[model samples]
Target: MDFYHRAGLILDALDNKKGSVKGLCMAEAKKGRKAGEGARFLKVVVEVLKYRPHIQHLLTATKLLAQEPTLFVPPSSTAAVASALKSGSAASANKALKTPRKHVKAAPSPLSLASVMVHDLLFAKRGLTLPKEHKVRKKLEKYQPALEKENEREKRRRKVATNEGLQIALPEKVASSLEGIGKGKKRAHDADRFAEEGAGSDGAPGEIRWMRVNTLRWTVEAAVEWLEKCGWEMFEDVQEMLAAAQSKPKVFALDAHIEPLLALPAAVSLPTISAYQDGRLLAQDKASCMPAWVLLMPALLDAEERAEAGLLYVDDEDEDEEKKAAGGDAKGKGKAKSKGIRVLDATAAPGNKTTMAAALVATEGINGRVVACERDQGRFKVLKDMLKRADAKNVQPMNVDFLSLKPDDAKLKNVTHLLVDPSCSGSGIPSRLDHLLPSAPEDEQLARIRALSNFQLAIVSHALRFSGAQRVVYSTCSIWEQEDEGVVMRVLAKKEFREAGWRLAPRDEVMPTWERRGRVEACGGDETIADSLVRCLPEDGTNGFFVACFVKDETAAPIAAPALPAAAAAADEGEEDAALEPLEDEDVTEDASAPAVSAQPVKKGGKAAKKAKSTASQAARKAKDEVLGLASAPAAAKESGDAEVKAPAKKGGEGGKKLSKKQMYLLKKEELKRKKEAAQE
Candidate 1:
């Protein structure tokens, strides 16, 4: 792309140029080519010398040649030049060149390159330009008073409203539990979008979710019917889900920070908004969405494995199908719904993609599962809370570490899809997010990064072992070589992983902003994932992210070492389920502030500047080896196909058998069955 790179390519081709490279370089320097090309040319010659015979000794032969720059001639022309020079004659290079031009190549003329500044830009000193304060100061002066007035008015309203007796409320866990989730720092917010305090704490300036509703012959009505039949009652108004689905799904972030985003063709139903809903259509960052398109292409999969997902984002075109193979519905609905397809969220937690995969599963009204897992306790709780609220039925939450999970341990069989959103530095994410975390020392951040990298490697390694996982989306919110391209490179370097079965993926599109990358070995033809990995940056109005896809070969070498011990298998499977013991303490409510909060005020434009911010916590651990391994038992239900209303197996206690809890926060499936039975009576 630049002279430095071009010169490198050119100099590399000079090894076969016959004339001694050093002599030629010296001659070129004398002709004014500069030391840059000379050094490059000599390096190429030395590489050639390593492989060729007498060429390595040519330097010895030309020991005195540089003293007289004219001595540097083509290898074939060298003998004649020497003879003429020894005979006391001024032998010009033209005499040797005129002998018989029999197809020999000419050495590059060094003089023409005198003006080249090969590495100029790579070493340039530059800074970004910003608007001067005076310009904006004058423009914004008019709005200052109005802004002050609004704050004054807010105080008066608060005095009249709450001064008498009113209290604000926090979410489910308590106001105190929201400690780290709130903002601690601020980014330069646009005046029109954010309040003075910034996008956090005081105002819920909530983040937005982009969704795309599926419209296959089955509109959301049909899908909802299927869900209703199966027992899922999302609290959002049914009409609202339908309206939201049909409407162009854009973002709905809270005030404080504004950003424009698009909802994919994903159907955001009522279950997506409530506290127990999948409020935001959690999916991949807009930029990283490419790798799922490219590297881990499931489109190349066989018909059965592709299953319903094979028809992502397609609108029916009866006119095109007869003339062209437009990808729409393949087989009849009945036939298509019988197949078993699955996807795994390898390191899923805080459940973004886990929930998205759930939406896709719900759309099919068929048997598909998303196995989502988290490695840490705090994040694992986040996953639990998210799944509970979103009513994500298709996903099976596992609190197992990815590295500790084996292909078989992933009891979710018949998986055709796998998504590994491993950990990495937040380079791909906006500085706005990292700003949320408190400032730590430089060494601490590095240590955190290294720790995250190790987990990332383990997740990918284990994911690759799953035999049923044909299509995988390996992603990270990082843009480092060690994590981005480097992880891919490490997988490539493993001779067995490469030879056993793996290849670069193909892509249907490339984001222009990231088209210039993928110049490393891991990129597979300079492509990110086998050259198909996609990278997203915050600057692009998308989450900073990286995504790569991989296709597994069924016939490739197996990736197993030994079977897991029986005891370990049981422990791993039952551990998390054993963790949710009920708190023995009494519920602690704010003693004095419960009055106004209990009223559920329907005020107008109330979430403005949730500015007077404050930040909140709880912990419980279960003990092992209880009596009879049963905490308690009872409460049974009717079994229907794959939809069993089996409650979470209670903790084993004095008698060893586990019991069930009250259905206050029941899973969708069980709640539905219970409701149906109650209605009939």
Candidate 2:
């Protein structure tokens, strides 16, 4: 007998008793001689359960036929079995009975037979069934008319329920009415209610096969045309395409939100598509594309501004010269080209954003360069391979911890933009099966989330410190407030960040067209910053994602220059060289004993000595500020020049009236008193 018929027999054998399907199946298998047949029997039983929930009712009906098989067994089957029994030879009987008699019917109850026939017919309707030549075929054929009538009745009932917006209740009224046969009325009512609510509900939004045309290889028009030639049909309306996807294999449509993105029917296998194999198409999530899109905003804005100023156009030769001047090779052939914008991609593994940034810059003819860094060696290798395959010429991959790189590293000096998509809990990604299921204990998951948020904060903090970094896009594939808005708020609250003039870029200024903004509650009720964030939830036809753009506040007041400590200034000035060089593997801590330095001179000296002393003091202060991250080295150097030029002039009374002899005498007396107090200490 085929597996389905065998499964029906097992259902009949359960005899309406409440028992574990798996346990009963396993017990039946042990009693069978052929192990493979037993395994196949279990497989069929599981499949049956997946589609049908009222197993008890199904079994109850089937059990009655087991006790009275004559009313249900096919006439031909009954005749054949009887004929074999009548043949007096014992050898003939043994041979006929060699196969398991569990499914073979000498007699059948009408109820059990009807139930089995109905199940097999339903499976057949759903395109799940055995071959036409199987032994169960004869029985199914005998019940064909009754089965067809019942099927038509069901179709009408479904039509009525759909039109009425009511849930499809149990098909057999007798199953609900009969006592001790199935669930009570209350349970049935709940099931019906649930079914009604879910009738039109598209379970999980169907997975969309999103493919982005690699503009580096092919334009969107060309890619679409190629797909058309390959037997794909493009729909103008995404809804129309999605509707058609339910019935067709290769229906495709342009993505409504993201450009150069096309959504293909979920049934269409991208790997089989020729363009994907050739790297002309990228299978990327729409949400995953947000980071690159946001990262490119600054460059695009700059281009627009330059265009408005009529300075956007540059000849090839002029561009090459500019590139050379900005540290590119004479031939402009190196990865570190200077004519385009520079981007730092922290945590850039698998190279999606890196390649996307390169593609965007290339499409705009901006000659942009991307510094893609990955900490994990394995992921770094993958990133390199992806970049190479994507034909991303503008990216320079680095296998180093982004946190380990100093904010003032020479390699990061030209990076005008930063893209940070750090490690996150990935709780928002439904595609990860583990994320779909219940995770570890609540405490454990919370701990992991906390650790991830801390790491995320550290990475973004480091990225913001890059000298001259005007824009940064921080993104995570986490839906948790801790990883998204929490990290943003914490980083923005840091004194270092405020000093550096960091603030969230307004959302309207970044991705103005995107409708879904971040959760304001997640940002601790800060609506201004919340509006600037972008969030993508799964129901929005994208993976859960959070992206926030930060930009340097050009209009904010410049941080005041830090003064040198008195101890630092008076320490022979010979210790300056040692302090300038950071000790290897040593943590630098502030010397609490060093009194805060003031800009004014405190000691009496000749004009020349005072000037020299002021100059040394400024240099020492600048060095200390750089080491302590109070100021960038380049900014400190510039400030040092201004202080030197202004210091002597103020003392010489060049810009203002000089103090009188009596006023100078009083200043000298006060200076002496302060000196006496310092000596007493």
Candidate 3:
């Protein structure tokens, strides 16, 4: 009836393997007990169990239980109680023990109840919240000093500084002896870890399984209710949810950064959940959701009228669906009025971001189209299947290399936004996840990174080439600076990128609350560039990831006058062009600084138009350089000193003479320098 009695009964059930710590506490709450009281009881039971081994050791070391024999239930009394409860014959076993509330003073205290009292006196910060006249309180007060002294002695023996330390440093022998002390077999380690600290003493946050509520099928509120109805308890704070999950079956918490996301215990069987199977809940990491959210929501939602001219809006008939997806009718308001917006997913395979973008666009009532392109045949099929499952009606899937698509083509010319998520080393994804890509040796890995970096840079540069494109969201599931910040640096260094009016979106327009920004050093120590990018590691409760948004400012003068010579401008072109080339019918010159002079009728804007034509000619020339493999000529010249390094002819034949030690060392040094330069490039 009382809190202590309730807690003792729960502990007794645990000892008898009747139920889990949370299950028993929840059972009490279901039986008309106050929710707060139930939580208190569960906390007490878990704390007692967590330190039960140490508490028992201390009790044995001090002989306190033996000295106060009447303070605990006897072995014979415990058996009689267990049998009475099991056989539904409480009166038959001990009629005198009926009505425990009135007779508790006369009966021996339950061993678990007595242990709870001892734990409070020795360890609880706010010790013993019971009345002074209470019999158990009076008994515990008598031996409080002795119990505290023994606890100190044990800590000193174990060389621990505090009670928490002593708990962590429990002797393995003592721990093995009480393997089932306070938690279920399935959650023994979890309980131990929770008791030590929320995420262990090292302070790395525990992994949480994140799911996004698919508003198309149900709202966040509906999803929450569905989970509760299915027996999962929700917590207001992620930390509290993690603690409860230690000895509980079903619990979840809302993600603070992303509104529509929920964090569940890692052990939850997600595939078996009805919501997941029905496609009402999407299995996605918090980091993976950032790109689409940035692209479709806060970043571009500011211009009300721009929505009409270029953005998409949901029809009034789909108003309720929009509200459901956005979490409220108020949030779903402000649909951009205008011609529908179009997006291109340059590397869209398996379509997670594609679906996410589609959802956000629909929820915001934006009239938008998403074109998803996958180069691989197998992944193209998977992308189509995902789009079908997600019900992304507006997306058009294509199986072709994104690089092969010309910006001026009819299919992509009107594309207003682009999502460029290309392949990388995949160092960000954990091995525990479904896929296990083979690892490469150090030398091969470096070479692979170089290749991947070039590819990523090329993809972003091509996205910037879309004349009608206003924004581009670039992302990768990679922790490497070379693939993330390195590619960003190279893109920003390009003459055409700025001429195209592309600039890194400010942090406020990005995911600002996200604490882990891109590596500042990787962005050449520029705080602004770093802030514009987002990064996630396992410690942040997501995979290692990097995402950045580039927005084209219409006010920017695309053909602004330059302050450089032609040769300097040509040499400053981005490195990605070395890995990209022009398609058929495009004419280009071999000279890096020479313009690809196409005799198209020049637009009649005079000086400004001529400047624009020259820029285009230069761009065409660079494209030709890529085709001719001359884009890397500058780097090669730097490495080999504008001429090939060669050994002089031998006295007899070319291979007949041996070189001196100094000459051999000089040749090796030059080779090493060339390799180093190649790596840097």
Candidate 4:
């Protein structure tokens, strides 16, 4: 930057030079004034006293510093080198020095513009240039004529050639744009949707929808009142909205994304109002509702199975009594309430299924049990937080994998219900992606998928081993057959694991349901693994999902445990036990080669043991059913003085001082009512 810096730079550059060097005269430096080099200035002022004491020291120090790129003189200083033959980026900058004008001037030259452009390196590699202003405008305009000509030619070409797709009667100019293609695709998706929606001759969206929001956060009364305040005409009936929203878009209720999860048509009703915004209501998708609803329905299990569980059954012991009573229905007084309905969501992180089950379990005075698990520690933290926010004490979190758990893990050992949502590739949904997965080499991804599936099967297999489990519901986000039906098939084909007792939940007349599209029939009432699996298509709903519920029959003789460890095998051999068997041949797939899980960690071990032992006292678990059945009150406009209740209360805290346990439960019930009211509003 200064005299010493310049002198030092010259020497450094010379040192960089590997060949013979030439003269660097002060007169020559002055000759190159346009170059702005201080080399000449130093020569004129300082060089006047050549041979001054210790002058060479100054030159050497600067020269040594110049060896590093960090110490190089920047492009700004390079202007000084112009007379000698412009060097460095400054040479390019000098060329770009535009002819000074007051207004917009001509485009910059190719070589000069290269210095300033951010992507200049890319362009120079291809020997490309920035377009001149005229050229830019002209090139853009030129596309219209050429594309038009191409369109005309295409129209003539396709007029006679029939392709198996939508007939493109419109000319190329009209059909070749994105607008046209998007319209066509939307129409196609619509056609697919409509056919699925209107399947089996007759269907109504509202009839298909069974509204069940976990009123834990908002009272139904408050929810409804808030809805009425929002100005949409309220109806206690699903039929009204179905009849109207089907004919008119104005009647369309709920968010576009929410409808598919509901797997029903939009309602003339509204799910969002001030009431929805306050976190009291969520317009859950219909297809998403199926997994939880089926788990609640008792009829899904066989008649013998339900009766053995003490469900309402007209016994032969009551034949004479039944006749005396006229109708075989027991109405009123001594009706036995459902005794402890405990559900375990083995992979329940983020609690989507857990929350849904909590809602399903909600009823006046009914306290249901839900033991939720999340194997991954980090995700379990999220599950814990969600349960607290939802005020969902009915469900507890178990931080262990399903296989690591045994019958002892469940608070209710003989509880008939379990919900298993395994980790999976979200292949069933068609959400836009940054990049298509198939493009990558996929060795890692495929390997991961295999690993996850192996773990999922292990969980389901363990769940089936539990006593009196009427339903073993297995689900995944994956669309791959290998992960979906194929995995299920492997379980079904196990010699020790016959499909003896299982029926998937069917569509109920009063509740919303998913299309049971892929459940093919199995032999001898034996559900083929694929036949029992339900695949929820993304185009029909908010997510891609698979649900399969296995009903294990204790009445059937217990099959031998498949694949005993060598230690267990040796113990069995000593006694010649018939209850032990070799591993199923079909279970040995190339992808499922991971060694058996070694052992659960000590902390997970402690909680699971405490949890497993506590779960045994099933009768102690209470149900919120008294709170759940609060759907009795019809649509009612909130009283004017009611502070005009609106959307559900937003999450986090019980609003103010911490609530005592009893009060927290009631507050959640009130919130549920408010949520239902808000959805209407």
Candidate 5:
């Protein structure tokens, strides 16, 4: 059959299948036609008609081209035909007839013919024209160049999109409508207020897969070798990776900005590597590692300082015994030493930071431990599992709310490092698709941001109160100024923090190589403090992240306590001397005089009278203590007796006022009750 004859048969079959071109093609391919060839023909035809805006227009255009052989043939074929005719040779004409023309099939399916015609009309540089009266002719002419370019682009886009299972094109109207919505000529005046400020008209870059080698499990060399074996090439530089990714068959590269971080092609799926299941590799973002890395600053500096001082610090063999002595009281009441480093993850869950911190501690060979706190039961289980998988032995996971933890809690008394990565809006994560959902109303979003900021401030401020804490890293995966610098400013502005002796560590000191600093002007924070804050944007090859490191200034003077009053000082001095008096002699005299003193009525008076009254009060107190049988009192009994004696002193005069009948009766009733209870025991 001829090309036109076959095209007619395909189109006729499609019409009978209710314009189901894809179904007809699939049925034909199953019956005997080459599946790949039939599918490719169907794809080309579908791409050409995809943006025509009307099914009727697609069918009409397809039918017209399928029915007419001349309209579907290319100009080159026509020229050859003409040249053969002019030669006046039957042999040349016959040869021209026998040769199959470009884009023309000896047995073309209906869909294939339609594809050739559509390509000629919309994409091919030269081809047969449609009838002037055709309904789609004027529209096609109006948007001919755009449609051609779009169809050409779709051919390239399909390869990546198909493998990723992602949609490359929106419906025709939706795509066109989006173009009109945001194409304003005037730039937004407040663009600087947003974290996406410097992103150009193209907006942020696409997301990429970031893999970090778990130094806890596998060395970088081992990880690189394993990945290379799986057909992945590692690039030493990020620019090199970017350059290589522009070509085909996606590649992987080591992240230039962060250690042990590897970047894989955005659209490629990682091969199933055993190392991943074994926890030798983790799929974590470059920015997410910033907190743990920043937290390691002190330990890094300590090592450098030791090296400079020519100190070969060795671990003590008696370290366990020393620590046992150091952790003396169950209440953690003794002064905690600064010799060892301890970290607290205030809101740890899924233990990313916890495991990272633990790994750093283990790798650095530091006398450090990480205390990971998670309140959520479900997430806590996940955290424990992750820690186990990461082989994090230095982490102590606690299922408890950070807010419920007191600054002086025994577990936290020795914690000198803190990490607060609280919950936020997660507005900056592009993959989370926050942008696709209709945004919450502006007021609602602001309210939510404010609430989040308050929570962030509370947790971070609480972390700073730890007595031994010398450094704290506050971080969040939020892009909004309210959740980033706003929280920082509020915490710093509090009056109590003035004496905290801590300030946001200068950015140049923490990750000095990083160029993206916080948006100080937009958030209205102190310029120096804001400059010290760090921000990571989606365009920066990271999930949007904010981190601020606070370090205690050891040189800053400690806050002085208010002085005691002169009278209180004198009183305390007197009590110190009195505490040395013989207890047995005092108790002996009081016990002998107890009955007479209890029967006597006390008189209130001045100095000499006060002296007389004081003597009587002491005798009464000693007698009461003897009656309570507390002379050889246990610690618990002493504490209880002291409390009871102090309670009645609040209502007394200088001479010690005589007990009223009601007070005496109540005291006797309490004594009887105590005696009854003790006897029963």
Candidate 6:
């Protein structure tokens, strides 16, 4: 009875818009509730919510609530009921609000309790959990035959043979037809349409249990051998695996596209397996694996090549030195600097992609660094635990927001690649039970997607700013076009991106063999850009997902510094003059005279390099105008000539005037300074 009582309270809270089913149950558990109480609440509550619509319809059709109103009336409402009968006035009923509980002759069962009882009566294998003599149970027993009849009618209407089929077979129109069931009140208690609860209930048909071998601790061969020892057989084709897995849960198949990933039946329980317990095998969805794989594919290929040629350890000292400079640990050799590959996982809490990247890096003795960033303190702790479990020693966990990080910061300056899997609307996650909850209003859902799109754009845009980044993979577990192709369109249209040579990596570099590309219309109808993007849905045997890769074009010529149009420039002359004001006069003079060519141009890449080039070019033109008496070149040409200024002195003088006596003296002094500097080197 206490169980039923607590369950009713949770359901009531859900109806009154207090919180989500899981959230409310967890809240209760935190308040000194019994262990496993929350789990029981979730299990019973989720099922009741899913079947409540049909159950309400059944009750109405059978007139069960009307015939047995006493059993359905709650104790709290008895005072009002008695007052209404006595005075036959709404005002008199309100006056009875303080009626004593013992004198009121209250009804034993509430509607919420009756509804849960009805669900168990019709659906549960062993009938109601209540005692046979319980008044609610005895009352429902009288309508058992009628309830059973309506249950069959429901199955007939949906053309399903078993009760389990109702889980996925319920039509949206059926729910819409029952609009009068819980009318008037807002359905604010419904779960987000996109929340994921992993695989459905036991023996769900056609559901695949996707798993990836964590190669950080062991090889794929070793994992397969261990599985064979545990009596699991490997099948070559996934279809064969699924077909045999229906009866034999010990069968598995290698995923064709993703090498280290495997497909098992949803019924297979790997949590108890030793390999899974220790984190050598992970239960990651096939869709979730795509982002890390796509981002690190090129690097993994290079690493494999080096391993095969026996060159992985050939220059240990040089590798360590590079790793130290890049702020990455080499071979778990402490925090010594090494020039190893570096990857940043922008929203890495839960560590799926973070550990995946680490494992991929370890596959061929590729010494690499992975910096996993998570802002939420609670989730950051989870990320640290996951990294430790996965034996991801190369990973450096940061409890800070990735958006707040400066790409030029010393620790992240040499990050060669990034994985931006930021928070999304979760609209694409396939849930086992969340659909049972009522959906958010359409306008509210759209507003949420808009907010999420802005966030996704901001995080990915930030990732592109990394100075040493060559490729950035922006991924989300969202199916919305706005968050997917729409974001890519906006990012590609950014002025900084175009000027920095950031473009979509070719399809060949992405998951080219995965047949589904992005929505063409979503990418503004450009087929090539759409083809470069990746999209996944549950129908593809994975959660709904999207991935887009942005790669820098190293071979592309440097962009000339940007110049405002003459008309626009004149219109904002005041603002431009203000912007040109020097922070410190001496600093400005030194910067203007200093060479614009960076000792390592690649280290100061992206927008930073471009801004420096533009500033230096403007200053050089100013010096030429003031000292040599040459007229300033047009804005476009003057900015364009910045790249040319890096040439030798002969090239600098080719089309310009010869050095004056004062300039000759300065040049001689600079030559002597350079000679001395070289001597010191």
Give the top-scoring candidate (TM-score): 6
lDDT tens per residue, model 4, 1-681: 233333443333223321111112222233344333322232222221222112222223334223322222233233323322344566554553542323322222221121122111111133213344634324323333543344345446657332211121323321221121113335433222222221110112322332334477766566555545655444433455556655544322332212212222343223233333343554444555556656765532343365566654332234346446857564552254334466778667556567778865654323466888766554566568667756787787887655455454345574568887664554543321202111324754454445455445545665765665777777765566555654565455444345344333333311333345343422222343344456776455334667666666646654432333332233223211111111111111101111122221122257776575344221111222111111111111132111111222333756633322222333343334444555534
TM-score, candidate 1, is: 0.38
Write the residue-wise lDDT of candidate 1 on 334-395 in tens digits: 33233445667765655645665665554432345567766555446656765765567667
Q: Model 3: which ten-residue window has the lowest total lDDT? A: 584-593
- Top-down lDDT ranking: 6, 3, 2, 5, 4, 1
Segments in model 3 whose C-alpha atoms lie over 4 Å from true places: 1-206, 303-336, 432-439, 557-681
Span of 10 residues, lowest total lDDT, candidate 1: 586-595
Question: Candidate 1, after superposition: displacement of residue 228 in Å?
Answer: 26
Global lDDT for candidate 4?
0.41
Determine the C-alpha RMSD for candidate 6 after optimal superposition of all C-alphas.
Answer: 19.1
Clashes per prediction? 43, 7, 8, 64, 1, 7
Q: After superposition, how far is residue 105 of candidate 6 from its true place, in Å?
A: 30
- Per-residue lDDT of 1-681 in model 2, one digit per residue for the tens? 334434665555444321223334434443454534433444344334333433224334345345445544454354345556678978756666664556455433344345444455655334335567766555556545654454455547656532112212322321122112113433433222222111111111235656778888888999889889988899976779989877888888997656777887644544467787788987677787888888785567677676566544333456667677878755534333235678888777667778888887775536677888876554576578779889997788987766556778785687888888876655565532232122357755554555455546556866887887988999887788777877777666555666678888887666777888877766656676678899989777777889999889868974333222232222213222222221111000000011122233345678986786567455544433432343343453355332111111135555753432212222333344445665644
Provide the lowest-lDDT 10-residue window in model 4: 582-591
Say which prediction, candidate 5 or candidate 6, comes out ahead on TM-score: 6
Candidate lDDT (C-alpha), each = 0.38, 0.57, 0.61, 0.41, 0.54, 0.64
Q: Can you tell me which runs of candidate 2 are displaced by over 4 Å? A: 1-205, 301-338, 435-438, 557-681
TM-score of 3: 0.51
Best by lDDT: 6
TM-score of each: 0.38, 0.51, 0.51, 0.43, 0.50, 0.59
Q: Which stretches of candidate 5 lie over 4 Å from their true place?
A: 1-207, 225-231, 246-250, 304-318, 321-339, 435-438, 523-526, 557-681
Q: What order do candidates take by TM-score, descending?
A: 6, 2, 3, 5, 4, 1
- Cα RMSD for candidates in order: 33.4, 25.3, 24.1, 27.1, 29.8, 19.1
